[model samples]
Target: MWRLKTHMLVHTNEFNYSCGYCPYRSRSRSSLQIHERTHTGDRPYQCVQCHATFSSASNLASHRRSHLPPVFSCDVCQRGFKFKQSLL
Candidate 1:
């Protein structure tokens, strides 16, 4: 599968794409495009809950979690957590 081939590039450190502005290289075309945003100052992904913006969708996804209410709570300390694993 293509996913397996992409995962193999991580172990082999073999990337097919190179950045024109820097020494950065990536196995996927999408990753290279995201990296290029760092040089271009292009933050296409914006948070709907806030004014914050990110160059990549993954970064925006991580930021969006901060706006979410905790789904799990610690029984002993009454601490809140967004994920069940975090409560553990």
Candidate 2:
């Protein structure tokens, strides 16, 4: 039973297959199938704020930060950032 459970967990965690031309990882077979679009340069998500497109949701989230005001500013140069931790 322990061996069977371990094997199942291994299968569940595996995302060993990857696209040869791009960096993308998917644990599920379906997700891997979807991720193959990157190699083809297919971006399905488009930003409503600026019409920018991204290959993945995480990239879209990061891109959205560009539309917002900086949360932190440089004390000496007056440079700003959307993230407070960027100050450090």
Please give each candidate's TM-score: 0.75, 0.57
Model 2 reaches what TM-score against the true structure?
0.57
Tens-digit per-residue lDDT, 1-88, candidate 2: 9668545756576776676566776555546655786568788888999899888887899889889998789999999989877888
State residue 60's C-alpha deviation in candidate 2, in Å: 0.3
Question: What's the C-alpha lDDT at position 37 in model 1?
Answer: 94
lDDT of 1 at 27: 86
| Top lDDT prediction, candidate number | 1
Best by TM-score: 1
Where is model 2 poorest over a 10-residue stretch in terms of lDDT?
A: 25-34
lDDT of 2 at 39: 69
Reference-based lDDT, residue 65, model 1: 85
What is the Å distance of residue 44 in model 2 from its true position? 0.8
Candidate 1 worst ten-residue window by lDDT = 5-14
